[model samples]
Structures are given as structure tokens and as C-alpha cells.
Target: MPSRGSATTAVSGLVALAIAVGVVAMLSIGVGSRFIPPDSVLSALFSPGGGFYDNVIWELRIPRTVAGLVIGAALGLSGAVMQGLTRNPIADPGILGVHAGAAFGVVVAIYVFGLLDFRAHVGFAFAGAALVSAAVWLVGSRGRDGATPVKLALAGAAISAFIGSATSLVLYADSTAFDEFRFWSVGSLAGAKADLLLAAAPFLAGGALLAFGVIRGLNALSMGADVARSLGQRVRLVRGAAALAVVLLSGTAVAAVGPIGFVGLTVPHVARALAGPDHRRVLPYSALLGPLVLLGADIVGRVVAIPSEVQVGAITAAVGAPVFIWFVRRRTVREL
Candidate 1:
């Protein structure tokens, strides 16, 4: 049970994060190569069609902004769930082979089928993530113990390494893939389209729900599996469901936006610091904070490179790495 003061603080912090998300989102829409003034940006938002900056605002920036919000929230939730599930501070979908699977799928689509369409990449990448997720569960749950944290972690690491090597080999041989696929690999919101966002909405929503559903289980598990079991938590069920959420959330995000590594890795720590160790607070905080970080980095990416924008992924890494190092030095509060 949280004290009245702490609860009040959490609610205040959440409100602040929500405001920040909105401010950054507006910046994302307005502050691009050809900057639309705030008044015009607001006007365009109020009356979207046939505007002065219709092409840039509605077509390009809006889709990208929407993608950032959805993907950032998804990655944040997935990372929080992953860290709790594995009890590893650095864990994310990458630790579960889910990300490697998506990357491999994209690599195959480019190398094998010569498909360059971003839409096509989404389907292929999602399929790969699904397959790898199932494989990880099966391998992790081998024996009567059934998906212990150590077993799951080890399984994911091994599968990720294998898939990574295969992907590297393919990229090494195919120069066309090397050139074309590298763009997606680096992660960028420039590729986001309305169709892709529509396609991903269901998956993202489902993932968010699943992540929230297991928060109690995760909080229980944080006390150790034996203790969790003693407390009537269904350990295996929680682990499986959390892993599925990671696959749905991080998998789809990677498929959609390529791999923006730092959003998931770093956001949870910030959430924990702000919201404390309780996952009910941590997960929600992370979802908001994730988009705030990603979109802010994206806004920076837009400005720093005048005519040609830097990819959001690159900017996130550049920005997030320093913040993460600071967290490590400070030993700030963390969820896992």
C-alpha cells in the first residue's frame, strides 16, 4: 500500500509526463526541416485538410509522430515486463531473441525475396519474431521446472546469438541488402505510414493490456519464484504471458520502426526512479516516459540535421546512452 503523499507524488509525476508527451508531440509535428510555426501547427491540428503544411504535417510528420508514441509506449512496457520477468537489469526483447528474430526476418525479406517495401518488411519481421518467441518458450520450459528465469534467459541468449550470426552472414554476402537494409536496421520514423500504423494498432493495444495484466504477477515474482508460488501466484503462467506481451509489443515495434535499442533499455530505469519499485506505477510511468524520450530525441534529430534529418534511432542512442550512464553512476532507484 502506498502512502498518501507518495501516491500524490506519483499522480503528479504522471501528469507532468503526459504534458511533456503532448509538448514533444507538437514539436515533432511543427519543428521539422521546414518549420511550421506553433500557431500554424495548432491551426493545422484543428483543421487538418487543405492546410498550408498539409503534406508535411498530415502525411509525413503525423504518421511519424503517431508511430513514435505507439512504438515508444510499446517498447517501454515491453522492457519493463522483460526486466521483471528475467530479473535482469539490462533485459529487453533483445534478451529473449525476439528482436534478433525481427531483424533476421527483415534481413531475409531484403536478401532472399528482394522486397524493399517497408510494409512488406513489417509482415516478415513480425512472423520471425513470433517464431523465435515460441522457440524460446519451448527451450526455456524444457523439463519439469518450466521456464525458470535462468533457463529462459540462457535460451534467449543462445538463440539470439545464432540468429545474429546468420543475419550477419547474409548481410555480408548481399551488397544490395547491405545498402538497402542498413537504413531500416538503424531505425527511423521516416518510414512510418498510415497503413503500417493501422496494422500495428491491434498488436500494440493487445501487448499493452497483457503487460498491465501481469503487473501483479511480476511484483509477486520479484520476491523470488518460491515466495511467489507460496503467495499463490501462477509463476509459469505469468512468465509466459509476460513473454508474449514482449513479443507482441517489442516485436511489432521492431518490425515497424526497425530497432531503437535505447528506448526500451533506458526508459524503465527512469520510470522506476520516478515511480518506485511497484510495477503498477513503474509500467504506466515507463509507457509515458518512453514516448517522451523517443519523440524528444526525434525532435532533436529533425533539427540537428538541417536539410537531411538524422534517424530517430541514432539520436535516441546518442541521447539515451549519456542518461543511462548517469543513472548507473547515481545508482538511482530501479525496478529490477
Candidate 2:
């Protein structure tokens, strides 16, 4: 175990890093087009109608920054919880099919039912994520011992594949659906609307709160179910609640931002590397770091292609895939 002073220092370092990243994200948000300076950006944020510059900051930069903040938090927290739940540093919400399920749900809503707007799609996507999670839990928890980490991971993979295939089939069958789904499936935060943010806020907020509650339980669970149970933690309830929170967060993020990849996978590992293994620290670190990674990527996406922005999803994949490969390669083949 690490010394107490060391742990505090580690958390302080991560907090500082996250704040620095957030500032960079803010700078990036104003760096393009009109190229507003940091002072102007601050003025815009504080006094929205101060001048023409303020309008640009309020209308353009603010939305993008807010989107980044929300989506980043969602992915980061989801990833940390997933890692803790499965005891796998490699675990992520996207890889487990929650995002795919939500994407599929939205496709079905738009294509089959013709719900063309963002507002109509959120509920469908949320329901779909909940359904996929339910399926994963049912299949994973089949045996006497309850869902082993291996079983849960495998179940998630299988379900993700099935849902992904279904999404493809739906797209291939309908050109109109393909047209709409094409951009969304890649996961960009650029097109998000204020209404979409409002719709997703409650779910995301509730999920984040619930996740924080489970930090102690997750820390105990890290020592194995028997150990956690002996310590008076209700293992099943804790795990179940965490999983529900994951569904809410990932689903809402997916609905608002599409099935963006890597935020969940990469942030948790980064958080743990910085904050140590305790879930108390890990969860908060992931929440902060997740947004930093995402917003940084978003800024990169904006600048990389100039007028033609690279999608945030694509940028994350480009960056995350190699890191994910490294994570897997470095990880020992333990149960989680």
C-alpha cells in the first residue's frame, strides 16, 4: 500500500493536471475561426452579451466546451466503474456494447419509427442501453457463483458484436437511415444541441452521484467478493447499482454524443496511474481526467483539419487504439 501522504500528493497532482487540461480545452475552444484570445473567451463566458466577441464565445465556444465537459465526465466515470466492477483495468463501457446498443436503439428510432430529431431519440437509446445491460447481467450471472468477471466480460463482448451487426444490417437496408446514422455512429460532439444536454442532464447527474456512492464498496470489492462480503458490504447490491449507473451514464452520453470510443477505456487507466488503485481516488480522478482527454481530443480535432473538422470519435480512436493495445499487452491475464 502507498503511504497516506503519498496518496494525498498523488490526488493533488491529478487534480492539478485535470484543471490544467481543462484550461487548455477552454483555450482550444476559442482558438479557431475568429481566433479569440483567452481573455476574450473569459469575458464571453461571464458577460455573454458584452459585445460581438461575447456572442461568438457564448454561441459557438460555450456549447462545444459544455459538450466536451459532459461527454468526457460520462465516459471517464463509466470507464472507472467498469474497471472496478470487472476488476479489469482493460474494461470499458464502449467495448462492452452499451454504446453499440444505444446507437442501435437510436437507429431503430430514426429509421423504423422515423423519429428524426435528437429529442425523440434519447429515450429510445436509453431504453436500448438498459436492455443490453440487462441481457449482459442475465447471461453473466447464470451459474451458482454469480457472474464471474470472465463471464461478464465475454457476455458483454458477445452482445456488443450482435448489436453492432444489427446496426449494420439496419443501415445497409435503408439508405436514408444510413445517411443519418453515418455521421452519428462515428461520435462527434459538434452537433449537440442545448435541448439534448438538458434531456441527458438528469440521467448523467444521477448516475454520477450513484457511482460516487459505490466508491467504498468498489474498493472493498477489489479484494474479492468474499472479502467484501465479510466486510459487511452487500456485494451484489453494490455491483448491481454500479452497473445501473454505467447504463445511465453511457446511454445518456451515447444519446447526446453518439457512440464515441476510448474516453471510457483510456481515462480509467490514466486515472489509476495518477491516483493509485483506491476507487475513492480513482473514480474522481477518472471523472476529471476523462473530460480532459476528451476536450483535448476535441480541440485537436478542430485544429487538425482546419475548416473541415475531424470527428471527435475518430480522433479518440486514432489515439485510444494504440493505448488500448498497450494496456492489454501490459496487463497480466488475471481474472479481471
Candidate 3:
């Protein structure tokens, strides 16, 4: 058990992160292509009467910031859960094929159903992510080891490759499909809206609950499956629930922002480093840390190009890849 001082420190860190998230969210709202003064931004927020700044704040920045908040939290928390479940320091949500599955689902929606509406893609994304994740678990858990880390990684890789190739094949011939898919595939919060948030709310909420529920199980499981079972942790059930949570979180994030990698892959490492191995602390820290990085990246994307903005996905990847490499190459990485 943590000492009183340690517990207070953890709570303090969380509160600080929460405050940072608020600050960055406000920055995201204020520092877009056309900068709105802070006073006007506040006025729009406190009271709105259908003015220019009101429209930008309400329609554009608010939804985008909200999307950043939710998606960042989901990716961060989901990544932490994945790492905990797999007992791998580098595990991420995409290792379960969720991202590839969601991407393929979007492609199918555009190619087969001819439904180009972004909202129309959500159900298919959920279906694809769920089915592929289920398949990964089944295939990976085959024979003796039963969902061992290597097996799950290999299975996810194989399935992701096959699905990615199939998606490319569909897009190769259809220029129209490619045109529609290109915008989404890049991953940006520019298109986020209130309706999209409403569509994703249930899944996000469900995944967060499930992730939090498995905290104790993850702590036990980290000691090894045999030890976890002896500790009365239902290893299979915990893994299944974790996988489902990852699917829901990753699926909704992909559906919302078109597969913004690194948030789910990289943020957890930082959280674990700061919060230590106890998942109770790690998960909440991740929930806060993920959004801070993402919203910061989003703000940077908006300003770097001025009139034209880079996609948030690209910015995160550009920033995250190097940071991840540095973490891995570190002499003393934090315990998983």
C-alpha cells in the first residue's frame, strides 16, 4: 500500500494534469486558423447570440477540442490497458488489429454501401473492430499458451496486413472511393461535430468503465498468469474484457478521428513512467496525459501552417515516433 504522502502526491499529480488539460483545451479553442481573442472566446462560451466568433467557437473549436479530449483519453487509457494485459512494455491498441479493422470498415462503407456520410461509418467501424478483435483473440489464443503475447502480436499483424491489402485493392480501382477515403485516412479533428460526439459517447463511456473495472486484475496478471490465477484473478475473463474495452475505445477513436496512432501507442509509457506500475494510478494519469499531448499537437498543427493545417494524425506520428524511440532506447525504462 502507498503511504499517505505518496497517495497525496498521486492525487496532486492528477489534479495538475486535469488543470493542464483544461488549459490546452482552451488553447485549442482559441488558437485555430483564425485566432479569436480570449475575451471574445469567453463571451461566446458564457453567452452566445449567433455571431462569427460564436459560430467558430461553438461549431468548430468546441467540437474539435471535445473530440481531442475524448479520443486522447480513450487512446491513452486503452494503450495502458493493452500494455497491462499483454505484460509487454510496448503494447498498444493497434497490436490487437483494431485500427486496421476500423479503417477497413470505413473503406467498405464507402465502397460497398455507398454511404459517404461520416456518421454512416460508425456502425461498420464498430462491427469491423469487434469482429477482427474477436478473431485475433481466437487465433492468437490457440493451443497451449492461450493468447500469449507473441501469438497475439503475430496474429494481429497478419490480420492487419491482410485487411489493409484488401482495403488498398478496393481503393486502387475506384478513384471516387480513394478520394473520399483519403481525407479520413489522414486523421484530423477538423470535421468533428456535436452529432459525431453523440454517436461515440456510449462506446467511449462503456470502454472507460471496462478499462477501469480491470485495474485490479491487471495488477495481478502482471505477476504472471499462474500467479494471477492463484490470486483468484480470472485470467481469461480479464483478458477478454480488456480486449473488448480496447476494441470499443480504439474503434470509436478511429471512427471519430480516422486512426490517429501513437496516442494509444505511446502515451501510456509516459503515464507509467510518471505514475508507476500500480494501474490505479497509471490509468488515470494516462487518461489525462493522452489529451494533453494530443491537444497540444492539434494546436501546433493549426499554427505551423497558418492558412493550411497539417493533419493531427501526422503531427502526432511525427512527434510520437521519435519520443517512443527515445523511450525504448533509454537505459532505465520504467517497469511495465
Candidate 4:
């Protein structure tokens, strides 16, 4: 159990993070190609007078911003849950082959099936991700010790490599698919549509709720599988629930915004550092920090080049890779 002072501090940090998310969301709406003033952005959002900037805000920026928020939260929570379940500090949706699976599914839909529409690809992405996640789990759990953190990580890495190679081969063979998937592969919120975001809402919300429900189980698991089982935790059930949550959250996000990496890989560690080892606090902090990091990355992508924008995925990679290296080198990041 966390001390009262620690709990209070965590609560306070969450509140501060909530405010920061709000501010960054506003920036996401206001700071874009045209640079709408903050006052105008507010007016366009609240008043709804049907002006040009108002239309831009309502039609374009709002949807993207909302997508960013949802996707960020999903990735963050997914990362946190994955790390907890695998007992690996480095476990992430993208690292675990989920993103590669989603990407491959979308490519197959476009190349083989001729399904060009973004909305139509969502189901394929989810299916692919679910299958790959199951495969990773199966391989990881094969050993006598049963799905240790090191085994899970190694399994995920091998599977991800295989799927990635398959994805590349398919793309190399199909010009049309290559052209269509290149943009989506890089990942960005620029083309996010309101309908797509709306469609993804239920899955993201359900995943988040499911993740929160397993907080106690995750906390016990943190102490190790034997300890968790000894404490009356149903290890299989908890693992199943956590895996389902990861599939729902990670698959949907990949389907929506392509595979934005680093957010999942880095945000949970940041959350744990801030709020201590408690999953209850770590989950919420990750949710808040996820958007803060992603939206900030998105904003940077927008401003870095005046006419041409960098993809959010690229920005996250640039930022996250260094942090990942630092975490590995610091000797402070303990294996879960």
C-alpha cells in the first residue's frame, strides 16, 4: 500500500496532468497549418457560428484532437497492462507484434482483397492483431517455467520480426498496396475522420474499463506469478482479461492512426516513475501522460516543417528511442 502522502501526491499529479491534457488538446485544435488564434479557436469550439475557422475546427482539428486523445490513452494503458502481465519493463504493443499484425492485416485488405477504404480495414487490423497476440502468448507460455518475462519478450521479438518481414514482402510485391500503405504506415492524426474516431470510441472505452478492472490483479502479479496465485488471484483469468484489453486498445489504435510506436514503450515507465509501482496509480498516470507525450509530438510534427508535416510516428520514434536507450543504460529500470 502507498503511504497517504504518496497517494495525495499521485492524486495531485493526476489533476495537474488532466489540466495539461486539456491545454495540449486546445493547442492541437488551435495550432495547425493556418494557425487559428486561441480566442477564435475557443469561439469556434463553443459558439459554433458556422464560420470558416469554425468549420475547420469542427470538421478537421476537433476529430484529430479527439483521435489523438483516445489513441494516446489506449496505447498508454495497453503498454502499462502489457508490462504488468509480462512482468517486463520493456513490453509494448508495437514491440510485441500487435502493431505489425495490424499493419499486415491492413496491407492484406488493400492488396489482396482490394479494400481501399480506411473504415473497412479496421476489422482486418483487429483480427490480425488478435491472432498475433495469441501466437506470442502461446510461444511465450511454452517453456517449463511458463511465460516468464524474458521468454515473453523474446517470443514477442521473434514474432514481430517474422510478421514484419511478411508485411515487407507483401508490400514489395504490390505497388498499389505499397502506395496506399506508405502514408498509413508512418502514422499521423492529420487524416483522422470524425466517423472513424466515433467508430473506435466503444472499443477504446471498453478496453480502458477492462484494464482498470484488472488493476488489483496486476498489482498482485507485480509481486510474481506464484505470489499472485498465493494471494487468491486467478492468474489465467487476469492474464486473459489483460490480453483482451491490450488487443482491443492496441488493435483499435493501430487501425485508426496506423502504428504509432514509442508512446506505449515509454509512457508506462514514466508513469511508474511518477506514481510508484502501484498499477492503480501507474495506469491513470500513463493514461494522462500518454496524450501529453503524443499530442506534444503531434504538435512538433506540425510545426517542424511549414508546408510538409512530419508524421507523428516519426516524432515519437525520435523522442522515444533516446529515452529507451537511457532507461536501458540507467540501471534503475528493474524488471517487473
Candidate 5:
């Protein structure tokens, strides 16, 4: 455990991170497609009734910025929850197959039902995520001790692979569906609608609350399940809560941004380095830092490719893969 001073420093760092994100987000809003000044960006955001900049800031940039923030926070928080539940230093929410399941749901909707609307996609995605999560949980818990973290993770991985293959087979059958899914599959914040954002909020909120509730339990559990059980914590309950939280958070993020990889895997590791391994400290820091990392990547994607913007998902994966490799090389994981 880190000292109190370290905690204080971490909190300060998070505050700094949030402020930095705000500033960078504002800069990004102003820098894109017929650049506006920073002052104008502020003016537009603050006084919506002011000028032409208001239209650009309020209509275009706000949704993208807010979506980036929400998705980033969701990924980070989901990673934190997954790691705690599994007690796996390298666990990622996507590794549970929630995203793949959601993608499959969306693919089915698109190809089978011929639904193309974002509104319809949101519902299908959530349903798919929930079903996949439940399936993984059930399979993991089938044998005996009710969802050990390792079993749960393995179930998720297996189920995810199956769903991914199903999606691929569908795509191979229908070229039209393949083209459409190709765009949505890359994970972006470009065309997010107000209704879609509203649709995702409940899951994000519910998941966040669930995660917060288990922070103390997670900290205890980290000490070892036997020790945690000795401390009167219900290991199963804690793990269940964490799993449920991951599903909501990770599912919502996938629904919002179409399974942008690596944020969940990468952000928590960054949080742990900054805030240490304590759940109480790690969770909040991950929440803040997650947005910062995501927003930074989004900004990079926007500028790196000129008029043709890069997908946020591609950007994150590009940046995250190398960092993830480094993490794997350095960390000596003791799986629970």
C-alpha cells in the first residue's frame, strides 16, 4: 500500500489530468476544420447564444468531446473492475468477450434485420452485451465454486472467440453488411447522436456505482481470497458485483464507440503506476486518467491524417499495443 502522501499526490495528479484534458479538449475543438481561437472556443462553449463559433462548438465538438470523456472513463473503470475481480494484473474488459458479443448482436441486426439506425443499434448492442456477460458467467460457474475469476475469464475468452467467428462468417456471406460493419467496427466518436449518448448513460452510471461499492472489498480481496474470506468479505459476492459492473461499463462503452480496443487494458495499468495498487486509489485515478489518455489519442487521430481523420479505435490500438507489450514484459503476474 502507498502512504497517505502518495495518495494525496495521486489525487493532485488526477486533478491536473482533468484540467489538462479540459484544455486539450478545448484546443481540439478549436483546431479542427476552419480553426477557431481558444478564446473563441471558450466563448462558444460558455455562451451558446453568442456567435458562429457556438454552432461549431456546441453542435459538433461537444458531443465528440463528451463521448470521448465518457468512453475513456468507462474503459478505465471497466479495466479496474475486471482486474480486481479476476485478480489478474493484465486483465482487460474486452478479454471477457462482451464487446465481441455486442458486435455480433449489431451485425445480426444489420444483416438479418436490415436495421441501420443508430437508435436501433444501441438497444441491440446492450442486449447482446448483457447476454454475452450472462453466458460467460454461467459457463464459468457451471462446475462448482460459482465463478472463480480464472474460470470466468476463460469462459469470456472462449465465448468471445466463438462470437467473433460467427460475426466473421456473417460478414463473409453478405458484402453489404460487411461494408457497413466495417465502418462501425473501427470504434469512433464521430457521429454519435444525443439519443445514443442518453441510451448509454444508465449503464455507465450503474456500472460506476457497482464498481465504487466494491472498492473496499476489492482491496481486501487483493490481499488473497483466503485472507479476504478470513476478513469476513464474501468473495463470491465481491466477484459477482465486479463482474456485473464490468459488463455494464464495458458494454456501454462498446455500444457508444463500437469496441475500441486497449483503453481498458492500458488505462488501469497507467492508473496503477500513478496511484499504486489500492482499489480505492486506483479506481478514481483510472476514471480520470482514462479520459485523458483517450482524448489525447482522439486528438492525435484527428490531426495525424489531415482531412481524412483516423478512427479513434485504430489510434488507441496503435498506441496501446506497444505499451501493452512493455507491460507484459515487465510485470510478473501472479494470477488468482
Candidate 6:
């Protein structure tokens, strides 16, 4: 249990992050190629009459903003849960092969089913991610140690590589699919629709619930598996639930906006720094900070290149790669 002072600080951080998310989301709506004034953006948001800017705000910006919020939260929370479960500071949702699996599914859908619609790819992506996650768990759990962090990491890496190769082969064979996949692979919130966000809502909600459910167990596990076992925590069950949550959250996010990396890999660490090691606070902080970082990245992507836009993934990579390198080089990276 966290001290009262720490809990209060965590709550305060969450509130601050929520405000940041709101500000960035508004920026996402207001700052585009044709910059709508703040007053105009507010009026359009409040009064959805038949104006051109209103259409742009309500029809275009709102959905993408919503997607950014949802996907960012999913990635952030999933990443936190993943690190907790694995006892690895750098463990991300992709470490379970969920991203690669989802990408492969999208590729296959494009080539075999002739499904080019972004909304239609959700089911295939979820299915692929779920299957790959299960396979990784099975492989990792086979040894006497029973899904140790190292084993799970190794299994996930192997499976991700295999899926990546398969995806490349399919893309190489079909130029049309490659063309479509290339854009999706890069990742952006430019074309996200309200319906697509709605389509992925249930899975995201379920995953978040599962993630919250395992927080106590995660906190216990953080003390070491032996300590956790002594404390009567069901380590295996917690790990399994965390894995499922990761698949649902990561897969749905990838399906919505393709695989936007580093949000997961980096956001949790920031949350931990803000809220202390207690996952009770860390999860919510991550949820809030994820959108803050992602929406900020999206806004930067929009502003940095005039008429032409950079993909959100590209912007995030530009920022996150250096942070990742710093993390790796740290003398004592905090493992929580």
C-alpha cells in the first residue's frame, strides 16, 4: 500500500496529466494546415452547426483526437502492466509479439481478403495478436521455471521475428498490398474515424479492466517471485491476465492507428517516475501521460511539416530512440 502523501501526489499528477491531455487534444483540433482560431475551434466544438470549420472539427479532428486518447491510454497501460509482469524495466507490449502479429494480420487481410478499409482490419489484427500471445505464453511456460521473464522475452523475440519475416514475404509478393501496408505500417491518426474507435472500444475497456485487476498482484510480484509466492499471490494467474490485457490493448491500438511504438516502451517509465512504484497510481498516471505524449507528438508532426505531414510514429521515434538509448546506457536502470 502506498503512503497517504504518495497517494495524494499521484492523484495530483493524474489531474495535471489530464489537463495536459485536454490542452494537447484541443491543439490537435485547432492546429492543422488551415489553422482554425481558438475561438472558432471552441465555438465549433460547442455549437455543431453547418459550418465548414465545424465539419472539419467535428468530422475530422474529433475522431482522430478520440483515437489518440484511446490508443495512447491503451499502449501506456499495457506497457506498464507488461513491465510489472515481466520484472523487466524495458519490457513493452511488443515484447509479447503483439505488434508484429497485428501487423502481419493487417498484411494478410490486405492481400488475401482484399480488405483495404482500416475499420475492417480490427478483427484480423486482434485474432493475430491473441494467437501469437498465446503461443508465446505456451512456449515460455514449457520450461521448469514456468514462463520466467527471460524465457518469455526470448519466446516473444523469436515469434516476432518469424512473423516479421512472413509479413515481409507477403508484402514483397504483392505490390498493391505493400503500398497500402506501407502507410499503415508508418502509423498516423490522420484517417481515423469515429466508427473505428467505437469498434475497438469494448476490447480496450476489457483490457483496461483486466489490467486494473492485476495491480495488487503486480505490486506483490515486484518484491520478487519468492516474496510474492510467500505473500500468497497467484503469480501465474496474474501473468496470464496481464498477457491477455496486453494483447487486447496493444492489438486494438495497432489496429486503429497501426503500430505506434515507444509510447508503450517509454510512457510507463515516466509514470513511475511521477507516481512512485505503486501500480495503483502508476496505471492511471500512465493512462493520462500516454495521451499527453501521443497527442503532443501528433501535434508536432502536423506543425513541423507545412502541408505535408510526418507520421506520428516517425515523430515518436525521433524522440523515443534517444530516450531508449539513454535507458540502455544507464548504470542502474530502475526495474519496476
Query: Which candidate should be chosen as best, given lDDT against the real structure?
Result: 1
Encode model 3's per-residue lDDT on 185-216: one tens digit a residue: 88898888898899899999999999999999
User: How big is the positional error of residue 298 in model 6, measured in Å on the Cα after superposition?
Assistant: 0.5
By TM-score: ranked, best first = 1, 3, 6, 5, 4, 2
> What number of clashing residue pairs does each candidate have, in the order they appear?
0, 0, 1, 0, 0, 0
Q: Please, what is the TM-score per model?
A: 0.96, 0.92, 0.95, 0.93, 0.94, 0.94
Q: Assess candidate 5 and give its lDDT.
A: 0.83
Q: Give lDDT for model 1.
A: 0.89
lDDT, candidate 5, 231-318, per-residue tens: 9999889888888999999898888788788888878887777667888888998898788888888888888878889988999999
For model 1, what is the error of residue 170's alpha carbon versus the real structure, in angstroms, after optimal superposition? 1.2
Residues 1-336, candidate 2, lDDT per residue (tens digit)?
Answer: 866437668667776977786686777668765678777777766766756587666666778788888889888999889889888877877545687788888889988899777668778887888788788888887887676678888898898889989989989999888887776778887777676788789999999999999998898889999999999998888988888888888888887788788889888887776566888787888888888888888888888988778988999999989877787677722333
Q: After superposition, which runs of candidate 1 have C-alpha atoms over 4 Å from their true positions? A: 1-5, 333-335
**Segments of candidate 6 deviating more than 4 angstroms:** 1-5, 50-52, 326-332
Error of 1 at 182 (Å): 0.8
lDDT of each: 0.89, 0.81, 0.88, 0.87, 0.83, 0.87
Q: Which candidate is the best by TM-score?
A: 1
**Which sections of candidate 2 miss by over 4 Å?**
1-7, 326-336
Q: What ranking emerges by lDDT with the best candidate at the front?
A: 1, 3, 4, 6, 5, 2
TM-score between candidate 4 and the true structure: 0.93
TM-score of 2: 0.92
How well is each residue in 1-336 modelled by candidate 6, as lDDT tens digits? 866436567677778888889999999899888798898888898887966699889888889899889989998999999999898888998889898888888888899999988667778887888888888889988966577788999999999999999999999999999998888888798978988888889999999999999999889989988888899988788788988888888888887788898999888887776677888987998898888888889989988999989999999889888987786676335666
lDDT of model 5, residue 220: 90
